[model samples]
Target: MSAKIQSSNKKGLFTKFLDVIEVVGNKLPHPVTLFAIFSLAVVIISAMAAAAGTTVDFDRVDMATGETELTTVVAISLLTAEGIRRIFSEAVTNFTGFAPLGTVLVAMLGVGVAEGTGLVQAALRKLVLATPKKLITAVVIFAGIMSNVASDAGYVVLVPLGALIFLSFGRHPLAGLAAAFAGVSGGFSANLIVGTIDPLLGGISQQAAQMYSPGYTVDPTANWYFMIVSTFVITIIGTIITEKIVEPRLGAYTGGEKASIEKVSDHETKGLKWAGISLLGLLLVMLALTLPANAVLRSDSGSLMSGSAFMAGLVPIIALFFLVPGIAYGMAAGTVKSDKDIAGFMGKAMSTMGGYLVLAFVASQFVAYFNWSNLGTILAVKGADVLQATGMTGIPMLIGFILVSGFINLFIGSASAKWAIMAPIFVPMLMRLGYSPEFTQIAYRIGDSTTNIISPLMSYFAVIIAFAQKYDKKTGIGTLISTMIPYSLVFLAAWIILFVAWFALGLPLGPGAYIRL
Candidate 1:
């Protein structure tokens, strides 16, 4: 692998720019290390700010009295003995109580089983390969978008499959890879159906919103409407980027290695059939539980989307939704022979999450410390004031926020981790600006997701580089980032446009969630 070829590809001007990003990004420390540094910095900053008598005032509605009262929040330094003791005491609780930790773990448990059964792989391959040659690109992009339903399945399964599919049809494999990567990572937040991230981020948003409005509730389906629309928007934009920009740059596929096309097996097909049936049956059962006036899943007022058992327990319900069908497919596919086999699959699934567990611990403590020290509140209030002073309001402020979030994503990879830290600040600030936490969450999601492909910090970026290495062994960080930069730029622009339009139209973000308070 030649380093020169990797850094200076024939892509010219853009490659040079992306090379800079790769170089600068590579200099940054690991995410865990960065979080540790950030935590320390927060402590020192909190101390300095506290000593300087930093404070902010915000109006909060009293739950009991039903009246608005002004409250002054003063930054508390974590440098004191009591602060240190509190930190040491709450360290374990912080990690254990992190909003996204358990939700992601439980969701991945079900996802792991499904992926372990080979059902997700088989289905994705079938979806891509079975499509007409003319629509292969569109289908690949759409499948990539839909693959978010199962965590990381799109990257591990669909991306390579897409490349192979395109290569088999005599198209550029890198273009195929780009298209699939765009859909999987860039369009991550856009899914026709609600995904694990919906609940994960929604939970974080709810926690942040509570800092201002204690009784405010954020449902998992809070961004369902916007994301559902985004599904098609991303698909179209991803297809255009792949067909117009990416493919033109690559020109033709003259790579030496023969692209190996993978096909679905008869047994895998049978497994998919049974899995689909089981999934449909599960949906029917869920519908039965929610559709009736006196149904168990309904709220006391018979509302399905608000204050309802089904809505409140969406995480567990999502877990079971994945678990049952996974078991069904596993049994049909001979993957689950006995109870031990199922247990083994579950364990294997958890084994992959070891890194996430570590990341979650450090990230949780950072968020908790920030919250306990009143830094998040004071910062948000002050930040809100600054934004207000800029005379940026409504759609423009929202657009500015999207760009800011996108910029932060270049450094931080974990969507939930970033949201965990950011939600505390941005969610409340936006709510004060007359926007809902759910609305703010969806904006963060767009920025976080759009830049995922271009960011070296993304957890799957290395995996993608390795995937690209199959065709070009010299492919390195610059090579991969350069290829993905187009998608990142285009996705950000198109998504922002969609968001602006949605905001202008005053459309509801989800079932009961609106753009503004």
Candidate 2:
């Protein structure tokens, strides 16, 4: 009886804590408040670091180089007006030239159009509906993990879709959303399919890790084999956690106001078919451009997969794929007419992103400030020293690194940036301790992706708030945060444990690769 009482007391405290979190989250303001808070927080962190004589290595290197020469790189200071002019003149020589800006923008245009069209939502609905009931939870989670490549696609599409699918099945919608978000946001590193982020981040990781190993070659798919398996692991774990812990607490759909099923008439269905045909045609054309050895889509080289213009321009291509099909579908389906209507759709899409835009603007500045200050580097180096001193080889070091990475993620929201700060220190440290850069990278990804579900600083936090609001008007950052915290905690624990087991068994992280050096 005493033991049961103690358990009840513990449960009571946890419930009270959740309630407090919900209350605090609800009280927080929207865009302006978030902006101010995040901005001030970054400023404060920067100042404190500066005051403590902190400096970060904000150096740029050519990761493509297979050089093994070790070097120490650190950020100096931001340029003033004269320095800005000097920077502009030397742009061509700069490693991080403005070339990427154009690529990113051009790609986003295509994405904007597709997201404006109802195609993404319609397809997701059909997918969720078609999945077997038993597989629904896992499917939702898996879909979330794969959606990362699309940027905000998972937050905008899958999260809400998960809730709707659950409601349709007479389960708690929030629980379903949690399951999907956990998979998408937290297990983002564990995609069963290929994604664009692989090459981009791999490039950065390669550059950073090379500080320790001049000959280090970080494969774009270094973590792919493990991620494929982890996809299922996360899906199952997410499903079980949601159904077991989350749903029971929420009780029922008594929260009211479920989104009504769209009554797609025969005409609408035909329009969808035509839209699908148009999309297929676009894809076929894209494939043709890709399939040919000497194709226009190929980069300066004749390669079409990686080095090709088509693959390198994937983000833009994806955006275009969505825009063209969505526009065609809209016209054929009679959901759109005239240039004005199309423009309106695009305009509406942009408007919906106002909050995100605000968040991103603030986040970019914060990232810039932190990078400029070089505190991340100092912290990471010190951390590497601590890890090195432990002399824990193999799994223990990997686990410790993952935990450290998780801690770092709390401070720096951008995965690439955090990895940039981390790779130089941990990669070299692990190398000396007899661990591989690939293993360090994988462990870092696990920690980085999992905590995104709960981090308020993530650019997508506001996007998730919008998703939650669709279910309950009362849903705010606090509600979303509180709801998803369970997922973040559970996923972090379960994933770390699984990673350790994989390490213990001395399983290869990928084909022909070992976790230990």
Candidate 3:
């Protein structure tokens, strides 16, 4: 009785904490409205800052000449006439040109076909059924960790599928969703294979490193080894958290009949077989294009990771890959009789994106306004100056950097964009203190990725909320954030400890990268 009382007391405290988060978060307006408010705030703040002559000057390295030059970033007041005119004129383009807008829509088209024909559902069912009962949570978490290879596609595909898989096993769907989201967003920077972000952030770090060492180049594979190790670290941590904390708190499956497991029929099994064959064929074709010395996917220099057509076109390639297999499954299942069915599937997918489209428009405007105001850059510069003044060095300093980066990540959603602004400052500062840009970059990544699952500003955060609402209508930003706080906090701590250990041991971060300069 006393043991049960202690457990109940712990549960009560946790529930109270979550209640506080929900109340505070719910007090805020809708996400769309919040973005609009942020946009307006940026404009007002920009005008005030410009009036006060706010500006930052930093040295920049010229890529072409390998020379250092001074550049100044003055606050740009969006309240000005030209700014107002530009904002009005560019609103349409901003909405249409948003990065997530196009990629998500294109990918969903193919996913829609697979889902509509029962292909995706059958495949997920098979995946879960094939896994040992004891390892279901681990499998979901591992799949989520690996899904980063396709970028944001994981948020769209794997997260909801995880929930469905858990539900079919008479488990709490939200716990499954949390576990997957933790892996996809929280473990984003950890992958066994080099991802699009490796090149993107590498390019930014190279530019920053050039300021201190002319003609310096940061390889895209700079963090590959560390991240490869991190993949397992995050998987193990995520699995443990899901099984011990999240699932227990969520308790047993209480959702209605829709959540029950249903056996796959013969037709769906046939569809899965056809889809598997089609997927294998696609893999063979991709290999044929990439493996040969003179293949089209290979760079002129014969490298697959850098300056390659394959790396550049991965998103579209993934879309087409899914499209073909989806169509094959649909046809095998007799759900698609003609090309019209395919078109319909794509159209239906696009239609469901209406809310996201609206959110994207407002979000794009806010992001643009923030950039135009130069506030993010100025804040980064000031933050760097403060860190530099601290006189801290070694692992402690890097841990401090990680904390700063995580805090900033709550406001800035885009990894590459934040890194672009931060690298020009932190990378050079760290280099002067006997650290390599690669090491600094990894520190930044640890902070950036761990907080993503909780940040409302993250591009797909809204979509995750929508996914959650399917299970519980009352699901809000707080519900997700509160649940994910454990993952974020634990991941941050574990990753930092790993980084410090690697640093102390003088281990190489990658093949050609080290912690110390």
Candidate 4:
């Protein structure tokens, strides 16, 4: 982006503040450096707390007999050398044992086939291209938000495609990147399609909540409606911010880089048609499986909303949902003609995972260390304890919780890990304070998502930096941080207002839910 600011463009205080953070944070240290600093700090804090015997000591439990009883104290402590050894010794076991890891990979296998067969990209391009320019922004943004249902596809496909889409229209590619990045990362929680992340985090949160309330549950899509609405809200906000704020600030396109456009390859066109058929067939099969009474796909409770078999197995279903059709489309489109061909498609999909594997490896160790140390548990329990002690109710408590979540996210970028650490203490503590698990989950999601753009520790930061390099070789962490900081601020402000207003209005956050405190 050009640094020449338009004379008509005026600076605001908040904009300047973001600019400073961008410049300062980029220069401070690499993301890995900052992450090491944080891990060290957590270790120290955990050791001190363990020494003090400050832990998640259960104050009391409301037993089945309706009596309050003091419960066993679960002390939160830091990892020991033994724990580190255990983690390293059982690295493979730990990797394989983590159900979500394999599940994510397996689910992606099918998604990769679908994407590799050129089904997903073609569909997106065709669908969005036909849309009017005014509506295109929202469509692309919404698609970017929904792409989370397929995980890394958004980063790999949508981000690049977004920049291309903007450049085709004689607009700055960075603006498109800004738009797509906002939806993909900042508005992560808000999506029309629910993905594996929902259940993974939900399960973790439920387990955490049970530390105090045995019967507590945290729904994966607890904030679905709000998020769905936020998709549109973010589209508008992102467009305005990109068009009115960042673009003008960066000035004109005098940069050395040349922007070239991509053509619709004949193969890509054929791929679209076959992929369309595959998508239709997949949809039909899903409907058939789900339509009949006592259908195999239905939940145990026989409702689509709760424990439905399909909902419960969303990860596999999502995989099959994409893979089945994609494979068929590939065969028809001549991308794949046999099982080996299919395997090749999957192999291609898996290839992209190399970088993710590296990130996940380090992230797993960090998470394991933190878990063993019990630092997260201690912080969570202590924070919840303070909240309960304050006796603050309703909006203040919820808003404050969001703030805390945002703060935690700066250090801990993994949503499930952070929630796993926080859920047990906060979920139950809030329940005791007369709140719902869903409400707490919703607040946690808002906080977790909003900071993703600004946090260097966010796993995708490296990928995003590479994305920027395509447009400007000079682009670095500081450039990315500066580019993304606007979305973080804008999204946080709008989302917080929407959530607080929702709280005041006393609306249900999701299906069969209430937001009352």
Top-scoring candidate (lDDT)? 1
User: If both were scored by TM-score, which would come out higher, candidate 2 or candidate 4?
Assistant: 4
Q: Candidate 4's residue-wise lDDT over 290-332, tens digit each?
A: 8877778987667876667775676777778888878776876
Give one digit per residue, the lDDT tens place, for model 1 in 1-517: 6887765565576667766766777788877777788799889999999999998899876544568888988999999999999989989999888777888888888888888888788888878768888898999999999999998889988888878888888888888998999999999999998888888898788878877777888888999999999999999888888998999998988888676776677778788889999999999999899999999999998888877998888888888888888888889888888978777878998999898899888887888787878887787788888889989888888887888889888877889878877898899888778788989998899899989998887888889888889987888887777788889998998988899899889999999899877
- Candidate 2 lDDT: 0.66
- Give the per-residue lDDT of model 3 (tens digit) for 245-305: 9889878866563664566778778888899899999999999999999998989999875
Worst 10 residues of 4 by lDDT: 1-10
How well is each residue in 486-515 modelled by candidate 2, as lDDT tens digits?
A: 778888888888787877787777644568
C-alpha RMSD between model 3 and the true structure: 6.0
lDDT value, candidate 4, whole model:
0.70
Candidate 2 regions with alpha-carbon error over 4 angstroms: 1-104, 192-227, 248-259, 265-268, 292-311, 336-389, 408-441, 455-486, 497-517
Better of 3 and 4 by lDDT: 3
lDDT of 2 at 328: 77
Q: What is the lDDT of residue 188 in candidate 3?
A: 92
Instruction: Please list the C-alpha lDDT of all candidates, in the order they appear.
Output: 0.86, 0.66, 0.79, 0.70
- Residue 108, model 4: Cα distance from true site in angstroms: 1.6
Task: Rank all candidate structures by their TM-score, best first, as comma-separated numbers.
Answer: 1, 4, 3, 2
Runs in model 1 lying further than 4 Å from the true structure: 1-16, 62-67
Which pairs clash in model 3? none
Question: Which ten-residue region of model 3 has the weakest summed lDDT?
Answer: 21-30
